[model samples]
Target: MATFIALVSALLVSSVYSAKALSSNYYDHTCPQAESMVSRTVKKAMLSDKTVPAALLRMHFHDCFIRVTPFCLAFLLGCDASVLLNSTSKNQAEKDGPPNISLHAFYVIDIAKEEIEASCPGVVSCADILAFAARDAVSLSGGPTWDVPKGRLDGRISKANDTLQLPFPTFNISQLQQSFAQRGLSLDDLVALSEFAASLQSVCPMHNKVKNAGANMDTTPVAFDNGYFELLLQGKSLFSSDQALLTNPKTKALVSKYACSQEEFEKAFVKAMIRMSSITGGEEIRRHCRVVR
Candidate 1:
């Protein structure tokens, strides 16, 4: 684990990306209604279905994890709707992969995209919509909200094999750290985002046969509190990856701190998310999310 962290630190310095292209007001001039439209759509979706918050949040993570940064141009996949593309006879899309089989909440993005198209007509990109919806989802679900920098361009490619880049549910602390580090995230960012996994267990169950079967990822799974870190302290974690935090003295100390400090957790989480939102550079806005314009 020591070696892995060291390697990740080196990679972070060498692979650091410039988030110069994105801005909080990227859409203010072209489509002032974009962000509010996405927020409204997400709120409506979550209101209609309580699971929307968790699902949307998961979808964003899955998108970001594929390339470590959703808008990263180095890798083909990002927050683009490529993940939503259906599998063809010749090739499978990311959604068809076994690991992504449980990935839901595409309809929510569709709804937001459609509405935005009607209002702004080919102005907002699917990549930006994803970032916005994700932020709103977390905020509505009792989590922190961060200003998402926009102006990300959607890519045309969507491949199933690329989904494999994501960390496995069984990844150990070292593996998890390496994965996040590849995306330019630090160990503290890993700990901060760990709380988001609190609701993941119920969506992705242990037993294949009982897919829907699950207990809360923590005592207060419904709330975006420090319950996840609290559960870790008690030796109760939904995934091996979550439990692995305790095996490392540093991460374990972070878990203890976040468990007791809501303000601290929220601050770190917001910072990490802001960093994640910077993966995509300046790209064109797609008229349609699923297909690049």
Candidate 2:
């Protein structure tokens, strides 16, 4: 029995190392230039080797939906303060924008570090951490995993492109679909991705005022579930982008499929995300893959 337990532990450790090696290679070969504040933050969190990127994402999710920075800071420790520097109000200023950072960007690193810390300690590579976090973040927020080419190496330069390419709140489906397909995702993935609407916030009353933005998409927006779809059925979309999910037949059918029954959305969403989360990252090195480190 002890031998079996030892073997199991060994296998788990080996898996972590393998993930790190593949992800690091991905960064080197693909995203060789992945140097940016976001990258650095990912590195620092992985460096902590304690928190999980998924867990961090969970916290970012909780705080954003709850509209409490303290909740964010609680899990992140002083990192939130450091990220904000001296200006606590900076978060508020940035709050009105799309909920990308808090929902996806911020939490990916947290979970990656949590995973790495369980195995290699400081030896777990930051690039690997970021890659894992990125893929998981997409899954966490209702996006597809697709095929992420690995072997990305860290470059010396950094820029805004990687951060900018993220979807905006108001972007139309035609454009958003192209963005996902470019990343190798499909329409099914796109439809399930609306589950991210669970991360919606009602900040400042007018923040989510699509047709009726101030309203919560669900009874529990903080929880990753199908509440957002039901909101679409009510014509109470907070973002123009969300309303389109119902009005646009190409995608609306999927939304209705979920809205008609959260059970349907929950099953499809979880399965699709599992498929997406299982993707390996930093595998492909294209001109656009890495930020200008």
Candidate 3:
């Protein structure tokens, strides 16, 4: 366990420290319509599937977690679109990895990529598209929105085994702290990011065998509010990792504060999202999100 944590910590720290700078106007001249194209795609998809927002958000989180290590690190390739790659007979991609099996809404990225490629052609990167989609998902769900820093390059290598390094749902408070700390995130960031847990629980409850056995993480799952924090105060969170938030005084107080004020929660959430998503690395902009160019 110690060795595992150490390895994860190294990966997290290195990825963040080696990140490249991104800009909100990355595609202004090249693809001015990129953000709008992604927003429309995500919005259109959500009209049929309410789960699209949560799925896209989860996809972004997952995509940003695993970095292309040691070799790619030299080239600054963290948070690349490695997660978008498909598994081949010789090698399994990160998407096929055990931890990513439940990650959906990848097709949303594909559709957005197609639209952007049609207009811009080899201009915007898949990594940036994922970031835009995540931002759109939050705004469309009535959450706060921000101008996403773009200009990420897509990574060329993705190994299924690397996904195992991601934090697990059953991680204890100490482990969770180490995981976030390695990424240079504070307890406040952890609490804010925990909002994603509520979104996940709303789509899939704990131990439900029924197909589409969706349960509400809070009273207003569709509204992207701080109801999750309120529910957490009631011991209503389903994941042990989330319940662990209350174990520490600092995080517990944050949870209480967010529960009492939706504005505080939204603010913290947006700040954390931008900080988290900004951990960037990749090689080249992939022509197709699913395959490297």
Ranking by lDDT: 3, 1, 2
Per-residue CA lDDT of model 3 for 111-159, tens digit only, reads: 9999899998999999999999989888877778998988888888888
Please give the TM-score that candidate 3 achieves against the real structure.
0.87
Using lDDT as the measure, name the better of candidate 1 and candidate 2: 1
Question: How close is every model to the real structure, measured as TM-score?
Answer: 0.85, 0.45, 0.87
Candidate 2 lDDT by residue in tens digits, 36-74: 333445434433322223434333222212211121222
lDDT of each: 0.72, 0.40, 0.79
- Relative to the true structure, candidate 2 reaches a TM of 0.45
lDDT of 1 by residue, 80-193 (tens): 556655676777777887778987778888888898988888788887888898899888766888889887776666677888888887999888877777677777888888
The reply for model 1, stretches above 4 Å from the true place, is 1-16, 68-73, 200-222, 281-283
* Candidate 2: regions farther than 4 A off: 1-158, 199-224, 274-293
For each of the candidates, the C-alpha root-mean-square deviation to the true structure, in angstroms, is 4.9, 16.3, 4.6
lDDT of 2 at 282: 24
